[model samples]
Target: MSRAAVPRMLLRGWAIQVKDSSSFGFFIMSSLIEPVIFAAIAAYMFRAGNRPDALLYAAIGAGMLGVWIVTLIGSGQALTFLRHAGILELLIVAPVPFVLVLAPITLAAATVGMYSLAATLVWGWLLFDVPLGVEHPWLLLASVPATVIGLGMLGMLMASVFVLFRHANALTNMLGYPVWLASGFLVPVSLLPDWVRPVSWLLPTTWGAEAIRTSMIGGHPLPAIGACLGLAIGYFALAALTVRHFERLARQRASLALA
Candidate 1:
């Protein structure tokens, strides 16, 4: 596609993805917000590990987890579903870059995360008595989008890798809980084994969650936000390289349409 066409492709692609995702009932309800309702209730009922002080943490963490799971499944499944529908070949053969085509879907998936975050917080307060207190309200607000941006870019790298695997859903299943726990979104990272901390630092979830938790707990969140955005840029660079490599490998092996 020409340079001017790229802008149009991105805008139209993003709009189409937003509309398509909005219409998916399962995506809106089951994957995005339903579990969060139950999680908030469960956490409150359990007193968030018998510490009422932790309930707010649990609520926000649950919101972040919703974002993580949805982005993971949606972005990873984008190419696989296209392959199943026989559009993968067309996207790959087109002059437009594959990342441009896939970016919007992954981003739209991340955008759903923002919705889940807002909905989780609102319902948690109204239904479960979860505290909405924030020591740094502005920082907390900023962290939500930073978290989404970081995760969405990370999703691109994930999608690139998933392009080579037929069972990407299995990978999403494998990653969800482990990442949640290690990232300290719902649980404090200190509770995990000492070795897990370093690995956690490398993952965007850790930074994103930290940005959020710090904002709530009255710590400096700017560094955390900066780290998340920095990683977003890094993930995009890595994703472009990996997409090129994996697309070539799949095309060479004739597995692009294997579904």
Candidate 2:
């Protein structure tokens, strides 16, 4: 790839995502608003006596949920739509890496997902009077990009896996909320079944939420940050290998063309 290729591909992906207002509206509603609403409900229902801290926790968890939604739902459905429209086949033949194409779409979705973070923070503070104080605001800020990178990699990995399926959207819906549940967003990892903790440890959502909370509540964020970056790299590598394998399979079997 040329030095400029990656940036160009990223811009192309961003532009495509932002081009249609109708589609963007759907992204906003599904990824941003819905997650915040879910969080508010969770906070209300689970509020150990209407405590601000508990509500704040739920708010942050909701923001993290947005991260998952934008990446998983966004990439899963985008790839499925591309396949339906016969664009996936064209991209497979394109000189740029197919993962590169998938990446920016995920990035764009994550960009939009920022609204969730902001909305949760503001909504919690304004509506519930949850204080917005962070013990280490800088760490909280830093976690944003780390979360995006980790989520983006996970999304790319999922896109690679999902590209092979015609019912990718349904598969995405099946996987999205379950991942959030296991992510320890609303529930503590300690309270989850022992079997689920190990799996949660491997997910970026687990680390992302941990990083955010630790930063907000005044704990060292290195552990959570390390987990997120490390797992992101692992997922990215797996995605590279898996995407190549699937591309070859698509080419040989012509499964990508059937849809």
Candidate 3:
């Protein structure tokens, strides 16, 4: 691809997603509703006296959790729908690179995930009076894009993995909550079992949650930001390789047509 090719593809991909989302009232409504509900519930649960800290933690955790879950599910569902509608093959055979097409759609889904962040902050402040007082405001702002891009890459990785499955939608939906739980977004990694901590550490969500929380509560964000950025780049690289490998296998097995 030329220098301008990827940028043009990204803009087109993002526009397509925006148009589709606007055309479908369900997407627009659900994107607004889900995050607000989740954040409100979490805020309510932690609204008891002498728990400003807990409430703040809940707000950020719940928000990030919503982002992760939405991006994961949305990305997988987008791919599955494309397969069912016989569009995945066309995308793969398109003139531009497939990752260029896929990445923007996932990022667009990540854009919806921003609503989760907004809803959490809004409801937390409105209902619970949770103070925003983030010490490292710039760091917190920086972490937002890093978190979204990291999670988008995670979704891209999942897309590659799901391409081989016939009932990818079911698996994608089923895995959403479990992945959030394992990421320890709502809870600290220290609370998880010893065996699980290692796995959680490797996840982008873990690094992302830590980064955001650290930025919010006041701490050095370099470690967390570094891990988040590093892992996101790593995931994107792996996703590209996985997609290439899977495409080859699909062609050999004559299964790309089936999806």
Write one digit per residue (lDDT tens) for candidate 2, span 122-226.
888888888888988888888877887788788778888887777787887788678887998877878878899889988988888889888887788878988
* lDDT agreement of model 3 with the native: 0.76
Give me candidate 3's TM-score against the actual structure: 0.88
Tens-digit lDDT string for candidate 1 (145-210): 788778888989999888677688899889988988888877788999999998887777788878
| Model 2 regions lying over 4 Å from their true place | 15-23, 48-52
lDDT of each: 0.80, 0.79, 0.76
What C-alpha lDDT, on a 0 to 100 scale, does residue 9 get in candidate 3?
79
Rank candidates, lDDT, best first.
Answer: 1, 2, 3
TM-score per model over all chains: 0.89, 0.89, 0.88
Against the correct fold, how does model 1 do in TM-score? 0.89
